[model samples]
Target: MTLTTVLLLGVAAVLVGFAKTAIGGVGSIAIAIFALVLPTKESTAAILLLLLIGDVVAVWHYRRDADLVMLRRLIPAVLPGLALGALFLAWVDDTTLRRCIGVLLLVLAAMQLLLRWRSPDTTRIGESRPAAIGTGVAAGFATMTANAAGPVMTLYLVAQGVEKRRFLGTAALFFFGVNLCKVPFSLGLGLFDGETLWRTLALAPLVLLGTWIGLHTARRLSQTRFDQAVLAATVVSALALVVR
Candidate 1:
């Protein structure tokens, strides 16, 4: 890697590490950065690997609070969506995928905003099979395409009235499973070669540092503040993706 790319990756790594704990969605910025500096397809694989590391940290921090029942409910729907996404990855054009993600984020954000307005005191809509399936499908497709699953899943979990720690735990575990499953396929696609692995190894420490900062910040905020921060960060990052 060029010095410039290394530097960029380092910076993006820290933000993503922080995002893993603070907002969850900012990892996409790292995805974008890698895609810009490296091959888009290859970067997809590398980012997934880094995200797996982040997922480990997230799960470790939030393990005791996970909502296992809800996790079980969502898995059936999420599995089919992930299969569809993996299929999409086999043929989807990079530009089309990016725009699709940008559009999806905007739509999800608007819907979430409308929902919040409709019930000012409520943080999440009632849990329903249909909603879980819908968001799970969307998240699966988006995550496979652009590593942008955070926002879609965020809306779904937040709507389910998940408490703070449980929400993070569930999200962390969900992504951990998804990304872990993705590893073999990503390698099959020739996205994770020796060079990328070496680079990721070189940058691994940044991931740890960023996660540390993010978790520390995460622990300081109230539940409401944490949720709001996640939402706000999602919206901002979504907009940034569109403009880029």
Candidate 2:
């Protein structure tokens, strides 16, 4: 990798940690960064390791706060979605895959905004079985295809009106489990070569640093502001992917 690519990957690593610990959807920005600096398909795999590291920290910190019921509802649906996404990955070319990721992010962002506008109080949409299944499928596919499940899962959690800490906790555990599930698929697809593993190791420290910063920042933000920041980051990152 060139010096510039290394620098960009470092930045993305920190963003991954911050997103895991603080605002979940902000990691979409890191996804766009990785896609820009690395090969499109390879970028998804490269970032997954960093995200898994961040997940471990986030899960440990918020272990007691996760909503186990919601996780149970979502996991079964996610399996089919993962299978579909794996097939999609095998069929699509790099440019098409990149554009699909951009479109997916934009659609997820729009759905969140529309839901919030329709019910300012934010109904417990996640309680609906169909809603949970849809979110789970979308999340699985997005994560498998682009490492962009952050926004999809965020929208679902926000619709359910989960408070900030529980939101972080639930999201942390969700991604941790889902990401672990993705590893075998990624490996089967030949996404994790020696070079990617080495790069992940080199950038691991920055992820820890970002997690620390995010822990402090999360404590200070109001629930409303936290949700807003996540949505804004998702939109901005989606636009970046589409236009790039």
Candidate 3:
């Protein structure tokens, strides 16, 4: 890889960690970076590894705060989504995957913005079975296809009115589980080769550093400002992929 690519990936690793611990949607920016620098399929595999690393830290920190019931409800729904995503990955070329990822990111960002605008009340959305299933499916497919599920998951959790720590905890565990599940599919798709593994190892420390930074930053910013900053950056990055 060029030095620029390496540097960008390092930055993305940090973003992965930060997103795991601080703001879930920030990881979408990392996804955009990976897709920009690497082949789309390879980028998905590479980021999944980094995300798992970050997930370890976030899960350990917020392990006790998760809503087990919600997780249980979502798991069944995620499986079908995962299957669908894996099939899509198996069929698409890099350019198609890249554009698809960009579009998905834009859609997810829009959903988040709309959710924020329409209501603060979580009860109606959170309690609906259909909503939970839809979120699970969407998250599973997004993660499997592009490693871009952070925004989708974040939108769901926010709609459910998950508190900050609980949100981090639930998201951490959820991604870890789904990502682990994705491993076999990724392997079958030949997404993980030696170079990708080595690159991930080299960049792992940045994820830890970002996690530390996120831990500090999480309590400082108001949710509105945080969402605005992350969403703006993600939209720009996503747009680049679409236009490229």
Candidate 4:
């Protein structure tokens, strides 16, 4: 890779770490940056390792804060979603799926925001069976297809009235497991090779550093600002996918 591409990927690598440790909705920026820097297929695999590294750090710190029951509800739906995403990899072009996913993210975020605004005291919207199934399936498909599940999970967790720390911890653990499971599929697709592996190894340290910074950032921020920031980032990132 050229020096400029390396620099860009390096920055993206840091963002991956930061998003995993401190926040939820900002990962789409890393996803977009990686796609911009590398070939599309290679970018996803390369970013995957970076994400796992960050996940390890975040999960290590937040292991005690996860909502086990909510996770149990969300986990079952992901298998079917992953299978569908793999099917998409086989027969569907990226452009088609990108458009569909962008629209889905946008709609979901809008609906969640509207619901929260209209009924500030109620968490039932996200806690319902239908919402659980729908968000879980969407998250799995988005993550599998594009490594872009953060916003969906963010909206769901926020809607459930999960506090910020719990949200970060739960998301960190959730993606950590999902990302690990994706390894065999990615290898089968031939998305990672010697060169990409070396690149990922080189960037791993930066991911750790970013996670350190993120932990401090998260600790210092207030809940209201954190929630607002995540919501804003999620919507903007979703729209970027559509506009691009």
What TM-score against the true fold does each predicted structure earn? 0.92, 0.97, 0.91, 0.95
Model 1 C-alpha lDDT per residue in residues 1-244, reported as the tens digit of each score: 6889779999988877787766776776777787678665667777777787788898898888777777776777766776777787788877666666777888887887788778864443547777777877787777777788888888777676677778888888888887776677676766777887887787778998999998888779898887787788678777766766
lDDT of 1 at 111: 85
Ranking by TM-score: 2, 4, 1, 3
Where does model 1 exceed 4 Å of error?
Answer: 121-126
How well does candidate 1 match the true structure in TM-score terms? 0.92
Worst 10 residues of 3 by lDDT: 225-234
Residues 1-244 of candidate 3 have per-residue lDDT tens digits of 7989888988889988988888777787788788888778888998888999998998899899888888998889898988999999989998997788778778766776676678857558766899889888988887889887777776677666666777777888999899999999999988889987898889899999999999999878776666555567567656766777
Give the clashing residue pairs of candidate 4, or none.
Answer: none
Give the number of the best model, judged by TM-score.
2
Ranking by lDDT: 2, 4, 3, 1
lDDT of 4 by residue, 1-244 (tens): 7989889888888888889988777788888777667665567788888898999898999999988889998999887777787777666665665666678888988988888889995488778988889878888888888888899899898888889899988998899988888888888887888987898899999898889889999999899989898888788778767776
Model 2 vs. true fold: TM = 0.97
C-alpha RMSD of each candidate structure in angstroms: 1.8, 1.1, 2.0, 1.3
Q: For model 4, state the Cα shift of residue 201 in Å.
A: 0.7
Residue pairs of candidate 2 with colliding backbone atoms: none
lDDT scores of the candidates, listed in order: 0.77, 0.90, 0.82, 0.83
